[model samples]
Target: MGRGRGRDYTGRTMPSPSSAIRPKRGKKGSETPIVTPVSARKRVAPSRQVVRGDRGVKVTRAVTIRRSADELYAFWRQIENLPRIVKHPLTIERVSDIASHWAASAPVGDRRVEWDAVIINDEPGKLIAWRSREGAEIPNAGTVRFAPAPGDEGTEVTVTLEYNPPAGKLGAWFAKLSGQEPAQQVTEALRRFKALMEAGEIPTTEGQPSGRPQNTKAKRS
Candidate 1:
């Protein structure tokens, strides 16, 4: 037979030379045809990480505001004011002497999740801390500290946070990809806080009178 154009041994239409077929054998005796399907094979996702301990990723940030230590501390002391400066503003539902209930937008893999946290360490204007209490899509803990700048009239605010992301590599991957890097978020928040405090206005809520006493409690350096 005069070399028929792209004819196979069975005399059926054959694929072009550019499109060749290679057969692959599988672990089983059956041959797994290596034909390239019109559609690609679905990717296999990497396994997720399991939760081990209560410990989470820790991050810290510090910034100096133009306001005095007393002013900054006073503003921070009001748990209700958190939503004004926090990257993801949170609503304070219940406030008490030592504890508060909060709801805020939190981060998840490529998404924003809502969570509820309970205030833990409430040392007035000096320090405040909270942990995920309920409705926590991503478990986390946070602390804010206020101090006086050395030799300067300004106030220095440091914020520390730890988060236990959802049980998956996706969580870890997304955490790294988050726009609000924990440290950067704190720094930017402090900067915004400084601007807002200097302007005598809280970012979200109505401007309140600003003559509160300084918190003299001890704070970390």
Candidate 2:
């Protein structure tokens, strides 16, 4: 064999390999796989968004009412008018142009919960957003949006609320079981608001007899 050449098993002359470095290969019929170390690998980000509270619950409800956005906005802008649309009694005492004090009966008991809120964003006839002040009994934040409905029908109102339940997840579960969860409350409130705006009154079964009324008037001949 020459200095730069070698003879293969078939007795054919082949050039010698270069001096470049190369990865070592395993034996015939066996292969080695490259693996990234844990510290060097790129981690995938979490898919879900991180909400405000550690145990926060968000509820959203929307309704279309046969009323103009301006009219609906006017009614909702005044903090005192909220009681008219809320089934569970609410009292809102205005402290300023953008702040108010709120009190409402607790879902699970006769006791009342109170919170102070200040409007964070407000656009006439379009949007209103607020957040409870620090030390509030129920820390919460919410937004109400009013937009013109499709086909010029009326206004579309959407309400979104985020709050940390009093006792965390357990309290939320109890509230749901009692039909007083934020979702249920928001749904009912929106329904009542729609009724009031479209029909001028909210329908209720209060003070109604269980059975059908008798024919108090005389029957026709």
lDDT for each candidate structure: 0.52, 0.62
Most lDDT-accurate candidate: 2
| TM-score to true structure, per model | 0.54, 0.66
Q: Candidate 1, residues 18-68: lDDT per residue as tens digits?
A: 222121235221133222111122221111111115334444456667667
Query: In candidate 1, which residue pairs get closer than 3 Å at backbone N, Cα or C atoms, i.e. clash?
Result: none
| Candidate 1 segments exceeding 4 Å error | 1-55, 105-112, 168-177, 201-221
Model 1 TM-score is 0.54
Clashes of each: 0, 0
Residues 1-221 of candidate 2: C-alpha lDDT, one tens digit per residue: 34212322223332222210121235221123111111122331111121233455554456788999999998888978999877766799999999999987655545677889887677899877777877775667777888888898998887766665567654664465435545556667888888888888899877655544453233434
Q: Looking at model 2, which ten-residue stretch has the lowest summed lDDT?
A: 14-23
